[model samples]
Target: MKVPETALPDERPNTGARPVDYDAELRLHNRAFRHACAILARERVLDIGCGAGQTTRDAARAASAGSAMGIDTSSSMIARARELAAAEDVRNVRFELGDAQTHSFPPQGFDVAISRFGTMFFADPIAAFRNIRGALADDGRLIMMVWQALEANEWSLAIQGDRPQSSAAFSLADPSLAKKILDAAGFADATFQDVHEPVYYGDSVEAALAWIGQFQATREALRSLDAAAVERERTRLREAVAQHHRDDGVWFDSRAWIISARCR
Candidate 1:
């Protein structure tokens, strides 16, 4: 399936979306989700925006009786994911490069469709959701997780100090907007729930800063700033995260929406 080009312009920064090394954090999120929701063991599943294919591979392993496929727009991510799957010797999982926002799926193909921190950048939320719904079988389910809001997510808020607030335009951060878009997309039984999770950066704060600095959007914002300015922003982020530090380590007070619905 091909992703429509229409929904990308709004979210695409001057530099395209880049590959991120969130391997550990992603695994953690996956584990937490498994705890919260019933695993689709033995159920055919499609993972949209499946970066690195960890979740897809995990699903295939955990649900050995089922088949799993992962799709993403980034070739680098897809390639890396394939390598990871091969290394892990996961035979039932496969990765492909595709646009999830507009990809066409076979009728009654997937029992479950899921995404993690994906779908947040969709330029057209309604259209994106509508296309996703087409991938599922009758009464199939959709499960996705996205940032709740800038204010509630200390990690995003810490990183985005003066960046323009998205309150004006359509944003996935707002749970209300999520419900609205899902409803408009013809899905039923929409629900949103809060999830608090820890994103361990490193042994120290500096390591965490270095890792997060690779974000394309965040880097673009720092492009115009002088070294002093960039450091100032880093200091602010450090202090913000420090508030959440404990004996275990520093953890950002992150928030996400666990949105679910079923196709009619």
Candidate 2:
């Protein structure tokens, strides 16, 4: 769930994958949120990089008595999120478009902060986390999921194909470095757990290609090549997906870090 080095709106291709790939996203990221929500009786929650507000809406349901706010840098995403919430008649949720890195979130405004496939793109992660930390109450909880190394994640490796790795997406892939960044950002009690999940690329090979081909990085990589070369690479991608195809869909082996920390 990483994006090319671009604005937040263009961060992801609107392949309608988020809703369809619920299993992948949940196994890799939301499992922690669900587990935490089950044990803790929370009142307020904040969801960052809350792509379509699904996670935000879920958290709002958990904090039914309180409220949940979803923030992202993409206005269109926020709009669609708002529409979804409205359609569901969910009143406890709200979505805003703003960069978490510099956004002045209300201080001590939330008891829990969550990010799924977000936070990796922050230009200055320490500053971003510090800002997020400030938005939490004392002893507040921070929960998020980050991708693992390139070698561990076959999904990205398949897409790479001699392409340069995305710096922003993989910036926090290393647990040690992620811990150091959190520590510097005034978060404590860092715990990183290994999570292996199946990421659904598409229902079929053609579907997968259509969705994956829209990735900004993919287009960038292919932009330099001629049609024949692009087709060759596309064929390679199709072949790679074939090996991982399943009865349900095209699933890629994925590895992520489920991180939990308390604001210091």
Candidate 3:
């Protein structure tokens, strides 16, 4: 279904920018995502919608025989990726900043393209997938991870308290819709597997609340609300999180779908 444009990251001032904790997220989920990279053991890789280049570097390691390139629409994210790549002294990886729908790659640019929670924001799924297919080699594969459904994910549901009215915020929860769009884009062998995981927060409930306030879009949208509503939402979140805290810290059960397909 078509949705109206609203609250895009670029519209906000460094609001949607990737946070430092995103690296921690990658480190935590890398083991879970390794299977997505396994199929590309000896093939070149492309990471579309790459955020800070973590998975790109991982794919590079997985495909030691071929190079890896990461592309993202956000210039700041691409800049951070380049810096991280240099600091880590990682070779065989490159990054560029441009919209995936319009960006051009060299002929037979990649043998495999991958994304982790990165391909879902596209305004035009078919056009974006077509661009991705154009960038891949004949036998190339594509793998990605996306939220399974809104109700199945607590991480997203927990922070829904303060979210404002926006088309973009509520649009990414449909797996069947996404599968249909991908099929229409000429992708074949489309498959989705459900994976349940836990997303952790800090040792204190307050800290967890603060992290969500800073990073969660729904919370940010609430911040745009009057002070009373914001405080009420904050209180609600704290109470919700208190029930989930343990000796280790605050944690929430989350669910996602690992989507894989081939360019056809």
Candidate 4:
């Protein structure tokens, strides 16, 4: 199951270089994996949107006799995943770059499917889950994490302000809606468990401001406002970060749903 080396750009999507948000978000996702690993059957596992393959490698280790496959749309992520797997000498894991919505996964090949805050961005969630169902063995488990409502997640609220509609992270925020979509996608017993955690943004206000400013959309949204208004917004954000500052770093509350279902 050893995979070959792949080249990546200077930065990857799920890496710390991309955004500090990803760092905290990744913690949430990986934390969910610890709970989801209970379903591993040591047959075969597939990690959808497996950014850097840490969870994929973990699954591979859990399924020592089997194999793990990590697939993501970003080639950089896939490449970095391969590098991590190689650096760890992980032979039972592989990474591929492909879109989960239409990727040609093997028929009934996986015993369990896992994702970490990765399945929410699909243009057609039902179609994507249906395709994922096709990749699983009969009655295989689908364990993944999606965000709760925008208002529930403090970090999202702080950064998003009045513009929470831009990101697809909250698409599955509603439990009933998520269950309905999964049911339509040929999955059964969709469940959402509330997971409250704190997301680390930065060690200082300057650091947090720098990281938060990386969000170009926020800048774009504020472009129409006069300089004073923009400064006021910036000051608002800085004060918000300062309120959450701690000895270790800046942390904010976040809420997520640990969704689990079975392929029907």
Candidate 5:
């Protein structure tokens, strides 16, 4: 299925024709986040922590008369994002490697800023957002998707069974705290919409296993186990993932928030 440039929250799944190598889990959230963005022509966009430029490219496509720039801390991810943009001939987008919290973005340069599960890792969210706010035009919008909480996401639980859930990914789980942070950072009217969707792992059990194994939590857990214990753990993980398998793919329920706010 060719993913639409924009979609409503209630739209049907559009991943049936996605490339096999695409990030399946992210594809689920992509639809909702892109829909919320609603990029417009001639509007400059900035994408924070844009992993591999998926969101940035989407924004660029929609903002055909404008331009989009993506920033991330990972050099490799930035490089890959550039490569993909070039390969796809998306000329209106660019990627940079930098930390959002301190990066000196052009003042009031962007009409919109966006993220996809990417705003949860700031060492200091208030400062980060303040900087972002400075980069936005007056009344500019911020649209982002963030995981609700570890307990609310089945994919994390299934993959890292029983492990103490501690990650930057869930930093913005509390709606009240998120609102407070945004308000303090010069944003107004922070609102959140609940998003419940099943994250796709892969088309088969083995494929899903390979993808899950690449997670830092899973790899760390396996490294701490002895060879025999590791094998047992792998077996356990396989069984857990298999439980969610369907004729089309492996999936797990997840909950997230699509938070939208405006620059004060």
Candidate 6:
């Protein structure tokens, strides 16, 4: 399905530019993540690295009487998340600017912790997951949606063809590695469910270009090129993106893993 645009107005002063909707590219993934979460009523949820609070707000809406709190390292993102939550009148959710790895969460405070493509960037995965486990109640759930191997995701290949892939985003692509980390972090019975879906880029080629151009990989690649080479790369990228445009939107095939575990 064509995901509706959830881009909110940028309230930041002096920028005079509409903030890029980072969530647009992952709306379909978010739908699947939400479905996999299946948050229960009265379950206090902690959302790690929740950009703009989209998932946190969804959890709050689902939990109804319960509450959701989102934590992120970006101050701007947290501010924007708060604004969106307030604007949407979602009173059961809140956002905080903090890193999950070292943030001191209230002990045994949350019933569940969730992340959407957010857990892979930790400088120390074991320490981060251990910290998260400390915040959960006995047998509290940990659910996350993470990308699979780079070879399995067409979206990454389309955006970054033949480039050396060193991104931390793919750190947990291996189930064995993920399970080991969880095991050391006091989690047990970890399971991974495969999720195949098309990630939406935008409604048109131009829109897709605008969105993809802001990617770190795109910027780094373009920054290393000479003027003519930069233009050539842009042309190539434009063509690659154009190949994915259709009547619905610019879509790319993606594969992810829905990982679920319980605190031991």
Best by TM-score: 6
Per-residue error at 224 for model 5, in Å? 2.2
> What clash count does candidate 1 reach?
0
State the displacement of the C-alpha of residue 2, model 3, in Å, after optimal TM-score superposition: 41
- Candidate 5 local lDDT, 163-206, one digit each (tens): 67766788898999999999999998989989998888778776
Identify the runs in model 3 with alpha carbons over 4 angstroms from their true place: 1-20, 26-28, 39-41, 162-175
Evaluation by lDDT, superior candidate among 1 and 4: 4
Candidates' C-alpha lDDT: 0.70, 0.78, 0.71, 0.78, 0.85, 0.86
lDDT tens string, model 2, 1-264? Answer: 544343122224335433333434355456655664442435788889988888888888878788899999888888989999999999988998999999989999998898888889998899999999999999788988778887888888888867778767778888789899999988999888777876777766655665566567887877777878877877787788778778877788888887899888
Q: List all candidate RMSDs to the true structure.
A: 7.8, 5.2, 7.0, 6.7, 7.6, 5.7
Candidate 6 residues 1-264, lDDT tens each?
222232111111123322237687787788889998999989999999998999999999999989999999999999999999999999999999999999999999999999998899999999999999999999799999998998899888888876777567889999999999999999999999999988887777766776776677777776777888767767777788889989987889999999999999
Per-residue error for 258 in candidate 4, Å, reads 0.6
TM-score of 6: 0.91
True lDDT of residue 15, candidate 3: 34
Q: Which residues of candidate 6, in runs, are more than 4 Å off?
A: 1-20
| Local accuracy of candidate 1 as per-residue lDDT tens digits, 123-211 | 67788888888878877888887777678766666667777655422267676667788888868887877777767654444445544
Model 2 segments beyond 4 Å from truth? 1-29, 37-42
| Candidate 4 regions with alpha-carbon error over 4 angstroms | 1-25, 39-41, 216-230
* TM-score, cand. 2 vs. native: 0.88
TM-score of 1: 0.83
Backbone collision tally, model 6 = 0
The TM-scores, one per candidate, come to 0.83, 0.88, 0.83, 0.84, 0.90, 0.91
Cα RMSD (Å) between model 2 and the true structure? Answer: 5.2
Answer with 2 or 6, whichever has the higher lDDT.
Answer: 6
lDDT of 3 at 22: 58
